[model samples]
Target: MLQHLIDQDEGLRMVPTDRNELTTAVGQLNEELRGLPEEADPARTRVLTRWIGIGQMCLGNHDEARTVLRQSLDLAAALGNTRAVVATGLNLGDAHRYAGDVQGADALYRSALNTARSHHPELVDFALQHTGKNLMERGDLASAKAHLQEALRLRITKGDAGLVESTQAALARVELLIGRADASAADGAVPRQWSGEWTSWLQSRTTAQTPARWAEDFPALRDAVRGLNAHQRVYPRHLRDQPFPAELIAAMAAEAEKAVAADGYLHNGKWNAPVGDAASRFAGQVDLAAVVARSTGLEVEQPHTAVYIAYLEEGQFLDFHVDEFGFGEANLILCLQHERPTAAPSVSTTVFITADGCLECDLAAGDCVVFDGALTPHGRTPLTAGESITLISLGFRARDQASRTVTNLPPVPR
Candidate 1:
């Protein structure tokens, strides 16, 4: 009854930004904690303590959150609740991260990861995801991407749409920073003559109203729709995967290293340095726009002036975000180089938010993943410790934009 009252009073949500709500939630949580059986039930006390700490966090009281979460962690540890331990660790890590202690946050996340890995592998993704997010904030893009990718791969395997969407958004943000795709649209500016099918599709999906398949001929699309009907929204569909010859991959990697070395990286944001010409030498021969159009059923022509390439060493990652629809209708990504033939290799993965589900697909050195940039949400995971990723992105204007011409303003320097 007390718990129900607390939930009702607090709206079963996070601490509200409104001063009255915050105070009320905190006070109610405190009252509940006081009433919890102290010595008779350690487990219950730990859970309530954790909730209070989370409430404190929602109110931006990191110091109080840390104290309370630490105590909860201790109790959970004593009770042998490994999952709770992991959860508490994550909460505490967030408190530290928000308090501007990156190292402390990393340590806590790593500790949680280790604990999860040993006793509860299913919980490893949580630790990795939080760590990746922290790394992104600390300017450690490579590590951030790597961790985020690991977490995303796990979430994909688990078929969790909500987690997958959130992670994809993080990865996408990282890519935009590196690719400088937002150069044309800064300051949250929307295009004057822009219309995206995503919003309408999102609305339809919300009401469980299935729409016509853009690519009815593709089994992947059909299967995705079937899964959507079954309430599964994290489907994996690979339109194509053809392995490039080892020699070709080597040559491409060599050119990429040289070009990035010569041109340097353009930093428009936090995580990535944009390389507009990662594979200019092979641009004419390899146009995957047609493949994208066929698979996604969107007319994407008029390739952007230059392909955006990102050269990421270990520890770098892209955050999740949707592509700028105003700049291009769709995005065609080609993985130029990835993974080493060593004993233990790390593969790079891309997470996508489809109309009905989430797609987490791994990319090899020669593979390509194409989707509607404006409509679907997507992002890439970080590279392995010793491995690096050199990939190129080609954006295509919508078919409707062919007849209409406007002076495209370049992205501003941040």
Candidate 2:
């Protein structure tokens, strides 16, 4: 009788004549799931749990959705139901991501991708979509684009209209971001040789190299990370009596100033002027990128994707947010200049609100700060009047190994 009632309710709610009626039908479905016998088959129970979890997610009850989906995933895995496991895992990953657990979502999606590859090759596209979406949200645009592009190709081969449409939309957005970054860059700011598909250039460097090899290739970078704080590291002009090349710094600053003019001031409560490709000339001319990579233990041979400048004027400040890109994880921030020089020289102070209380530092001109901006939330308090700061950012994907679990999954069977 209860099953019949749920079926009847679902039929009525299919079109959802009204919000209240649809919600009531969902409540009926929930009650039916709850009324199932304690001795019910685990697989059957998991099916119900998965449905309930998906419904909860659609209803915007993310916390309940995750709880329900986790139960489904656990039961499905124990039963060795590869199909159910992949389904529940993907749903649960989305739930966790919606709840702001990005790291957890990435892990879950990676595991799902692994399971799908080994047991259900047909589900590879589904798993890739979820993984790519999570990375995109986390600001790993380069990785996100790769995953989405692959998923789109698979979906095309499968001839799935719905999947193709959605994946294309995602791929387009990634392209748009790349396009914006390119358009915003100063003309002649980057050489034509450096102008090819930026993400593809990055992927080309994903050779099978161990961290030890990276350490050997870039010893200075390894040393820098070793002395890093939990969330950040500072590299003083170790050359002592010598600071960064003023000529190089000046060239970067000029490009940044021009970019700001072209792009206009970006304001989201706080004003910021992003100078695209501002540091390209310097990074391209000298071994600055190698030094930056070495400083962060990244591969010395791999090129950084983006190098830009940020002009933060007085009273303007950046809010706390983690980097969404892989390159953002090991960001190289160099202070170019600051107005209203103090006795100690004006600086843009950063406050890293970490799990271990707060760590504050004054990032002064000519000094470089290398830190995993993705793992922690760091921001600046508003600068005082007549105070301004220019910072050059070198963003590279040095931690490609973290993605191997998903990307290196066995290829889908023909």
Candidate 3:
């Protein structure tokens, strides 16, 4: 019931895939399992354990998952459940691979393949497919090709289009790996040809973003996250060098005071991703957030802005990225008003400037930093692990929108 409540509550409806949620959900499942009969229902227990293990693995808790899934595999073996064992072994292989025990992964895959042979042809083929994948990762191209080919033949004979297509894709990937792997081994430091091509391509594409360009295009922040998977943080860096002003801090506090009880949909008075049921918060807080937006000439793009709230002792941060694509010409971090009385009276933006500035700006409660968002996708060096720090942002499309009736400091001397 507790898990259900969290899942159902809109306020608690964060991304299910996030590590926090995964860990929480697994904890809940463990509690429920403890309450069950010692014998428990075998099938139910297996299913729950598998999913919980998968969730744990997702959160980088491989050791915990390994123990749980090993138990699950043992149960499967007791029931002669070949398919279940195969699935468990496959995921276990992944855990081992990620944990850097490649040899262990190879052995497990081989074991699963052997176990699956006595089962149906489909099961056998499935096991072989995974084994081939493992072999490919180990650079055993001949064995990988042989296993994958056998799996492909079995799928074709069984007239299973899905399996056939999947095996074929795997085969193609293996061939590609072999081609690259061989070259990688020979070159000792990346193939010179590919490196040269990539370098030239990067040179052609590289162009630093200017602060003024942020004012020219109103890029949405939500759109930027979709393509920036490799980036570990997301906050503006260019503005961290500047000192936070005293007057701006006062204005920000005043505004945060006005935000009390003003939240509706998107503005949950808490941190939330932009989406339906939160859209109202996005548009409603615009007036308050715009103050910061215009000051920095940066727009907030969480799909739903008003719904995005950062609370005291809380902050929202995006980890590193090039912030490429048309997400925005630049990114800005704005200091918002923290109206509620707290240990920290005012809010400030913190930008870790890395260039000649080597400067760490206080990002005073109201002062904001503006920087090249597109060229250097920003992110907090260390994403706050506790609840996200509360923040207000405006994803600006036009510079006119950035300080709409709001005043910004003079641009640093060019």
| Clashes per candidate (backbone, < 3 Å) | 27, 7, 52
By TM-score, the best candidate is 2
Between prediction 2 and prediction 3, which has the larger lDDT? 2
Structural similarity to truth (TM-score) of each candidate: 0.41, 0.43, 0.39
lDDT of model number 3: 0.50
Sort order, TM-score high to low: 2, 1, 3
lDDT, candidate 2, 262-299, per-residue tens: 65456433334444333544554567546656565565
Model 2 stretches with alpha carbons more than 4 Å out: 1-22, 181-414
Error of 1 at 336 (Å): 51
By lDDT: ranked, best first: 1, 2, 3
Taking the tens digit of each residue's C-alpha lDDT, what string does model 1 give over 1-414?
122222211111223446566667668878878876646688877887888887777666767888999999999989888899998999888877765455567789989999999999998888887877777766677787888888899999999998888678777655655455356445335433222232333333332111123234234433433422232111234645553355555566665566566654654221232332224335434555566566666666746534436636654555334344444656667677765538545454676555455566777677777665443445555555676666666677766554321223222111
The true-versus-predicted C-alpha distance at residue 93 of model 1, in Å, is 0.5
Candidate 3 residues 1-414, lDDT tens each? 223322211211112444565677779888777778977778777777776666666565667767777787787778778789887887677566544455567778877777777664458887888778777766688899999999999989999897898889888888888888777566533223332332243223321122222322223322332332122223344333234454544444444333433432332223333212122322333353354355454454432222234444334333233332233433445554433324543333243223222223444344455554433333342223232243444343433333211012111111
For candidate 2, which ten residues in a row score worst on lDDT?
Answer: 5-14
